[model samples]
Target: MNYETFAPHPNLDAIVKCHWILEVPGDMEAPKQRVIPDGCIEMCFILGDDVKRFNSENEFIIQPRAMVFGQITKPYFVKPTGYVNTFAVRFYPYGFANFITQPIHELADKETPLTSLFEESSIKELEQKIIEAASTKSRIAIIESFLLSRLTDKSIIDNIVTSTIDSLSQTKGSASINSILKDDLSKRRNLERKFSKQVGISPKQLGRIIRLQAALKMMLNKPGENLTQVAYENEYYDQAHFTKDFKEFTGVNPKQYLDNDQMMLSSLIYSKD
Candidate 1:
C-alpha cells in the first residue's frame, strides 16, 4: 500500500486540508478498512476499481466513482473490489459549505454522488478530465480548477462556527463550550443552529471527535504509550472515559486498534495529518 498527501494551492489552503492518494498493489489482498469520524468531509474519485461501503454485517453498496462523503459520526467498513487507487480531497469541517446549497447537517453519514451536487453535465465532464489526467499532479490541478470554478457565493464559513472550531482544535477538543462562551451564554442555542447548518455536527460532538483524534494520534505516534498516558495527555477524565469514547467512534478498544489491519487506512490518514 502507498499513501501520500500533498498541500493544496495557497488560495485553497484555508478550506482544503490536503489532497491525498492511496494505492494498493493489484496482487496483494486488500483488507477491510475501517474509517472513523474525523470531523471533516471528503470528496473522492476512484480511478482504479469500485469500493464497497458496508451498511450492515453483510450488506453494502458500491461507493460512487465520484462522490462527496459527508460528516460521519460512526465508523464504517470499506473494502476494495480489486486494486485500490483513489484521489481524495479532505475539507475542513466548514470548508465544503462554500460549494453547496443544502444544509450540511442533512448530509451527515451519507455519500452523495457528485452529479447530485453539481450539474450532471459538468460532473460527467470533470470525471473524464480527472481520469485522463497524466499524473497525480495533473489530477490535483483538475480538481482545484473544478472547485475554484464552483466556489459559491454563500459565505465559505460562519465566523461563530469558525471561532468555536478554532478553540476546539487548539485544545484538541478539550475546550469547554460554556467556558469558550462565558462572555455570552445566551448564544449557546444560536451556536448550535449554526453548527447544524455549517458543521454538520453539533459543537460538542465535533469536539469529542477532535479530542478522540488527538488521542488516536498519540497512540499511533507513540506505540509505547499506555491508555492512561494517552488519555491524560488529551485531557480525558480517565482511562475509562477515553476507552469509551474511543470505542464509540472507532468500534474497537484501544489495544485492538494498536496493531490491527482494520485501522491501516485510518491510521495512515490520521498519523500523517
Candidate 2:
C-alpha cells in the first residue's frame, strides 16, 4: 500500500485541506479496512478497479467512481475489489459548502455521486481529466482549477462557524461550546442551525471527531505510551471516557486499535496527519 498527501494551492488554502493519493496492489490480499470519521468532507475519484463499502456482514455497495463523501458520524468498512488507485481532495470542516448550493447536512454519512451534485457534463469532464492526468502534480493542478472555478465567493463561510471550528481545532476539541461563546450562550441554538447547513454536523459532534483524531495520532506515534496517558494528554475526562469515545467512533477500544489488523489503513493515514 502507498499513500501520500500534497498541499493544496495557496489560493485554495482556506477551503481545501490537501490532495491525497492511495494505491494498493491488486494481488495483495487484505482485510476490510475500517474508516473512521475525521471531521471533514472528501471528493474522490476512483481511477482503478472498484471498491466496496460494506453495509452489513455480507452486504455492500460499490462506491461511485467520482463522488463526494460527506461528514460521517460513525465508522464504516471498505475493501478493494482489485487494484486500488484513488485521488481525493480533503476539505476543512466548513469548506465544501462554498462551492455548492445544496444543504451540506443532506450529504452526511453517505457517498453522493458528483453527477448528483454538479452538472453531469462538467463532472464527466473533470473526472476524465483527473483520471488521465500524467502525474500527481498535474492532477493537483487540474483539481485546483476545477475547485477555484466553482468557488464563487471565498467568504461564504459564516464567521461564527469558522471561529468556533478554529477554537475546537486549537484546543484539540477540549474546549466546550459554552466556553467558546463566553456569555453568548443564547447563540447556541443558532450555531447548531448554521452548523447543520454549512458544516454537515453539529459543533459538538465535530469537536468529538477532532479530539479523537488527536488521540489517534498520539497512539500511532508513541506506541509505548499507555492509554491513560494518551487520554490525559488529549484532555479526555479519564481512561474510561477516552475508551467510550474511541469505541463510539472506531468500534474498538484504544488498546485494540493498536493490535487490530483492520486499522492498518486508518493508522497509516492518521500517522501522516
lDDT of 2 by residue, 39-144 (tens): 9999999999999999988999999999999999999999999999999999998989998998899999999999999999999999989888999999999989
* Count of clashing pairs, candidate 2: 0
Question: Cα miss at 116, model 1 (Å)?
Answer: 0.6
The 10-residue segment of model 1 with minimum total lDDT is: 150-159
Best by TM-score: 2
Whole-model lDDT per candidate: 0.92, 0.94
lDDT of 2: 0.94
Off by over 4 Å in 1: 152-156
Q: After superposition, how far is residue 119 of candidate 1 from its true place, in Å?
A: 0.4
